[model samples]
Structure formats: structure tokens, C-alpha cells
Target: MKLWFARVAGVSASQMLMVAVAWQMYDLTNSAWDLGLVGLLQFAPSLLLTLPAGHLIDRLHRGRLLATCMAVQALCALALAGASAQGVATREALLAVSIVLGAVRAFQMPTQQALTPLLVPREVLPRALAFSSVGLQGAVIGAPALGGLLYALGAGVTYFVCTGLFAVAAALCLWLRYAHSAASSEPATWHTLLAGVRHVWHHKVVLGAISLDLFAVLFGGATALLPIFAKDILHVGPWGLGLLRSAPAVGALAMSLALTRWPVRRRTGHTLLAAVAVFGLAMLVFGLSTSFMLSMAALAVSGAADMVSVVIRQTLVQLETPDEMRGRVSAVNSVFIGASNQLGEFESGATAALMGPVGSVLLGGVGTLVVAALWLRLFPALAQRDALVQAGTAEPGGRARA
Candidate 1:
């Protein structure tokens, strides 16, 4: 539990840095497209390098690898701080630094996920995950409000503080101890890489789980465009922007804690779909609201709905994956997550540029709803399977019966 809390602190710090960057970039450029570009730059390296990083995790010590990645992330944060201090805060420089951070993330996320099973007892994995996620919520709730305050101080100071936080996170990583899984006995080859891809793509359950998140988050994530709404529509400043960023985390945190006491035990598939649908509706309400309080309320509801989806999706992934293949599979999972988030940002920015921010957000909500309905109709096997299926006990639905 202590280890999980430590990991959560690191994750929360990283998220704070990310939110700070997004808010700062929007302030600097005053352009929604530029804000979206930050996500593209930050996630581009993960999209490109995560597969290779996963392969490396399978062949290396995950603990050492995670520690190394955190070190690099710290350096990237410091470099960004230096760049900002030097008054060299060009869009290109911001994009470059973001890419460097993304490169670090490519390995870090998979290593962290794969490392968790090593740190906790099998029966307590779910609880550990919940605890880790709660810390992330803490960051989400506090970081942005603090980040926005810090950003109001100056971009350079805000980045320097983030650098310091990441440095602390690196030090924390060094304190964690875990045994590595055996190095891949198989030779590192293109065929081996392809085999990992084949395994995830062909697995109906994995594919469905990743796809569900991909489509829902891709279309439903209007939170990425918050700065625009906060500034242009709602007429709120950086602090309100931070509050907007934190709303979903608030919702997610509440739900995560509630579930810790009463975990999701049945109808997982139907629940996930319903949660996403509610998320979409919440987003639509957020998009159209002209009142500041109304916007905040709507965003909070969206956050709550998103929390439900995250729990269900994570439970599905952890319950089904094999120990040996976790690294590679988690890499694929990172790609899907990164694509949905980063690409969704790009889409939001582009659409906002073309059709105005309110219109773009509303359309995204509608699209999320459409995707959920389609997924439910098309992926009947996934829709039917509501509980984790043990390897030997997989049913026709590809999961164990609840």
C-alpha cells in the first residue's frame, strides 16, 4: 500500500506537469489549435516508441527501466524549465520538450503497470490498483488548481516547480524494490514483435477492451479543450481553468473510493457502456452551458461518468492478461490510450478551429454516444462478458460467468 501510494505520487506529479503544460501553452498561444498540438507532440513519441519500449521491458529489469525512465523525465522537465527561463518558449521548443517527455512515458507506463503485479499479492491486485489510482486523483484535484496558480506567477516558475516534482518522483522510484521477470528467452526479432501484436489483435477480449476505450475517449474527451471554454466562453481565468481540469479527477476519485468499499462485481460490460453514455451526455451539457457554474457542474458529472469507465476497463485488462505477456500487451494498451487522448486533442483543436469550440465539443459528445451504441451492437461477445474469465475457464463469451 505504501509503495502504491508512492507510485501514485509520481503519477500525480506527472499529470500535474501535463496539465500545467496544456494550460500554459494555451495562454502563450491563445490558440486552441496550438493547445491541441501540445497533446500531439506529447503523445507522438509514445505512439511511435511504445512498442519497442515494451519489447525492451520484456527483455530488461522493469524496476531499473522505470527508474531510468523517471530520470529522463526529470531531465526533460528541467530542460523545459531552462528553456522557459531563457525566454526561448517557442511553440517548437515546447513541442520538442513535450516529445522528449513522451519518449520517457513510452516505457514508464508499461513498466509501472507490469511492475504492480510483482509488488502485490495476486488477491490484492485490485486493491493496489485502486489505491494507486486514488493518489492520481489527489494530484488531479490539487495539481491543476496549484498549476494554474503557478502559471499565473510565470511560465518559467511553473515549469521549474514541475521539474522539482519530477526530480522527487525519480528519487521515489529509486526507493522501490521489485524482482524482474526473466529476460525473454526468444531472440529479439521482427517476427517476435509481430507475434506480440498478433496476440493482442487476435484476442477478442483485449481488442474489444482497448477499442471500447479508444472510441469512447476519442470522441467524448472534451476536457482537452477546457482552456478555450474557460477563457472564451465562460470568461474564467487560469484558476477556473485549473478547476475545470480537476473536475473529472474529483469525480473519478470519489467513484474509485466508493468502488474500493463495494467493487464492481457484475454486469461490467453493460455498466461500462452506460457509464460512457452518461459521459457523453455530460460532455454535451458541458459544451453547451454558457453559465460558469453550470459548466463546472456538467464537467463534474462528465468526470464521474469517466471514472466508472476507467475502473471497468482496468479491471478487464488486469483480470485477463497472462503474467508473461503483460509487458507487450500493456504496450499495446498504452498505444491505444495515448492515441485516444492525444489524437482526441488534435481532433478537438481542429474541429474547434473549423467550427468553433462549442460546436466541436457538442459534436464530440454526440459522436461518443454513437460510438457506444455501435460498439454495443457490434461487439456482442464483449458486451455479454461481464466478469473476468480465468485462462482455463473462458466461456463462449470469452470471460468467466459472474
Candidate 2:
């Protein structure tokens, strides 16, 4: 729980910085294309560097790697703060900083996911994952609120607060520990990277589950073009923009906490599909709603429903993957997940450029539903599977299965 708390703090700090950056960028440029460009800057580095970053995670001491990344991120935030304070903040500089931060994130995700099982027992992995998701979602909710408030005070204050938070996170990282093994001592190379890809491709359940969420979220990604919705359609300012960004996180947090008591059990496949379908419907609702309250509510609903898909997909990845292979497999998974976010931004940006933001979002919702329908037809075996948990099947170290 202590480690989880620290993770929450760190994640919240990062997210708050993101919200501040997005708002500041939009305010400075007053363009939807600029909004998408921020995402693009972040995406390119993660997409390009993920494999090497993941490999390094497996090879290095995870605790040290994480601390270094946090330190770098803190410095980056401080730079942004300085730029903002001087009235020299430019969109180009923000994009450059975003790229550096994205490179840091490329290394962050795999190391974090690979380290989870080490902290908690495998049996409670699902619960732990749920809690972790809660932390992330909670940050989504809180960061933007705090960020908007800070922005109201001044952009410099927002960036300063973000820098301070990053420093706090770095200090907190010193308290979290991981149990290393012979597996982590292996060499990192191109050959090893290829092996990881092969492992993921051969594993049907992992491939199917990751692909499922990737496709669904990729097509229905509305968050990418939020600036347009906030300014034009919803007629709200920075505070309202923060609220719109946070609505999904609120819904996701509610669902994550609820799942602690009633864990997802039987018909896992069907449940995943159902949750995604609901997400699509919520997206459609969000796309159509012009009222600020209604649009935020719609986004919140979409977020809550999407949490179901996230838990199932994450649980499957943890439970199915072997410890020795966790880093590599997760790296492959990162590509898909990262692409879903980055490419989705590109898709939204390109589409919005052509056919207005509202139409682009509506079409994305339609695409999400269509993909879900096709998935249901293709993976019937997944739909028919019982609980993801198996009684006698423990992990390699006699630990209970995730």
C-alpha cells in the first residue's frame, strides 16, 4: 500500500504536468492542430524507442532506472516552468520538451508493469492492478483540477508546482524495492527483442487480448481532439477544459474501486466485449452532446465502461506471461498500447482536419462499435471461456497465478 501510494503520487504529478501543458499550449496557439501536435511530439519518441527501453529495463536495476527517469522528468518540468515564467514559452519548445518526456515514458511503462508482481502476491495481482489503475485514473481526475487552479493563478505557478511534484515523486521512488532474479541479469540485444515479439505472437490469449483493446480504443479515441470540443462545441474555458479531461478518470476510478469487491470472474471474454460496446455507445453519446455537463457526463460513462476492458486485458497479460519473459512481452504490448494512443491522435488530427472535429469523433464511435462486432465474430472461443483464473495452475515459482 505504501508503494502504491508513492506510485499514485508520482503518476498524479506527471498527469498534472500534462494537463498544465495541454492547457497552456491550447491557450497560446488557439488551434486544434496544435493540440494534436502535442500528442504527436510525445508519441514519436515512445513509439520509436519502446523496444530498446524495454530491453534496458530487463537488463538494469529497475529501481535505479525509475529514479533516473523521474529525475530527468523533473528537470524537464523545471525547464518548461522557466520558459513559461519568462514569457518565452513557445509551442515549438513545448513540443520539444514533450518529446523528451515521451522518451522517458517509453522506459517507464514496461518497468512498472514488470515490477508489479514482485511487490504483491500473484493471487492478488488483479486487485493490485485494479488499485494501480485507480491511482492512475485518480491522477487523471485530480491533476487537471489542480492544474486548472494553478493555471488560473499563473502558468509559471502551474509549472513550478509540477516541478516540485516531480521532485517529490523522485524522493518517493527511493522507498519502493523490487526482487531481482537471474532472468533480469540476461543480455539485452536485437536477438532478444525479436524473441520477445515471437513469444507474444505465439501466445494466442495475450495476442488476442492486447489486440482487442488496442483496436477498440484506437478507433474510438476522442480524448485526442478535446481542445476543439472544449472551445468550439462546449463553449468552456480552461477550467471547463480541465473538467472535460478529467470526467473519464472519475468514471474509471469509481469502476476500479467497485471491482475490488466484485472481481471479474466468469465469461471474461463476453464481459470485455460488452464493456467495450458500452464504451462505444458512450463515445457516440459524447460526440453528439453539445452541452458541457452532458458531454462531460458522456465522457465519464465512457471512461467507467472502458475500465472493464483495461482490467481484463491487463489481468490476462500478467496471468498469461512468464516471469522470465515479462519485460519483452510487455514491450510488445507497449507497442500496441502506445500506438493506440499516438496513432489514435494522428487519426483524430488528420480526420478532424478534413471533416470537422465533431464529425471525426462521431465516426470514431461508429468505428469502435463496428470493431467490437467483428471481434465478437472472430474470437468466439474467447467469448466462451470461463474465469481467467485456474485453481491448480500456479506460476513458475509456486506463486498463485495472477
Clashes of each: 1, 0
1-402, model 1: which lDDT tens digit per residue?
434655655665676677667776776788888878877886888988866887887788766777787678777777777877887777777778778877887888887777776666555555656666777887788888888888777777777777677666666666666565468788777776655577777777667767888888888787568888888889988888888888888887887787777666677778878888998999899888999888878877887787777766665665566666677777888888887888788888888899999998899999989988988988887788766433452111111111
In candidate 1, the residue pairs with backbone N, CA or C atoms under 3 Å apart (3 or more residues apart, or in different chains) clash, namely 389-400
Whose TM-score is greatest here? 2
Clashes of 1: 1
Error of 1 at 239 (Å): 0.9
lDDT tens digits, residue span 306-383, model 2: 899888887877677777666766777777787777667777877888888888888989988998888887776666
lDDT of 2: 0.78
Question: Which sections of candidate 2 miss by over 4 Å?
Answer: 182-185, 391-402
Off by over 4 Å in 1: 389-402
